[model samples]
Target: MEEFVPSAAIAHFVMKVKDVESSYAFYQGLGLRGIDKFPEMAIIELRGGTHLLLAAKDDPMAGALHASRVGQRPDFISEKIDLMIAGHTRADLEKYRAELMANGYSPADIAEAPLYGHDYFSMLDPDGHGVSVYTSHCGDKPV
Candidate 1:
């Protein structure tokens, strides 16, 4: 057998949301692209060139696929996933966090960690997915 070589990469991350529409709106407000084709799935494009797939719990086709094919349990959807975003400085993250708070979402517990530098706060989207806003000051490097 020969080793497989890669050409390019495409990735999709799925998170379970109790209400797809609400989550869609939430992510959309965070400057994420693509929100119209929702309810089936809410897709958010991150600043770091990644995609987020917010899957609704009440979606029938999702249930069918998971149940019939994936052999997943009825409740096998994760409530959250840590999404890493990039910014140049702590102030940059703070500006965005303020926008998030103004939109009625609490960007909680700004903290500086040993691994990552002077970053602050995280927000739970309508679906309870944690969106982390970090800057490159407190830690040696961004993880």
Candidate 2:
């Protein structure tokens, strides 16, 4: 069989949280474009126009789609990979980390991944979802 390829991209990432406003602010703080927000939901746009849908835990459609979902607990922190965003370079990661810190967010110090040799840092969002920002590393060599 011949190799198959498809041109597809992510359109939306749905997240349920107890406080839509808080989650919305977090994404906006990360420089993601926010397309207005209400008490129940928010639509934040990524660079590729991908929308990160932050829905209130009790949102009708969100509740219907999932049997159960939990919100963040102040005492617990999740270190799992919830989302990963790529910057143009390692310097971008450093600047972004500074911005996050200025905004009162304590992101971990940037470090290089030994396997990939790209810089990255992780922080918990308002909903306790782990988010990683990394320097972009695509393809095998220069284009």
Best by lDDT: 2
Per-candidate TM-scores read 0.68, 0.73
For candidate 1, the lDDT comes to: 0.64
lDDT of 1 by residue, 1-143 (tens): 55554455445666668887778777788777863455487677765446777777668767643444354455654545554445666567777777777888777856755234445566677655567655654233323
What does the lDDT read for residue 67 in candidate 2? Answer: 48
lDDT of candidate 2 over 1-27, digit per residue (tens): 554433566777667777998888888
Tell how far residue 107 is off in model 1, in angstroms.
Answer: 1.0
lDDT values of the candidates?
0.64, 0.71
Estimate the lDDT of model 2: 0.71
After aligning candidate 2 to the native by TM-score, how far in Å is the CA of 75 from where it should be?
19
Pairs clashing within candidate 2: none
Cα lDDT, model 2, residue 33:
92
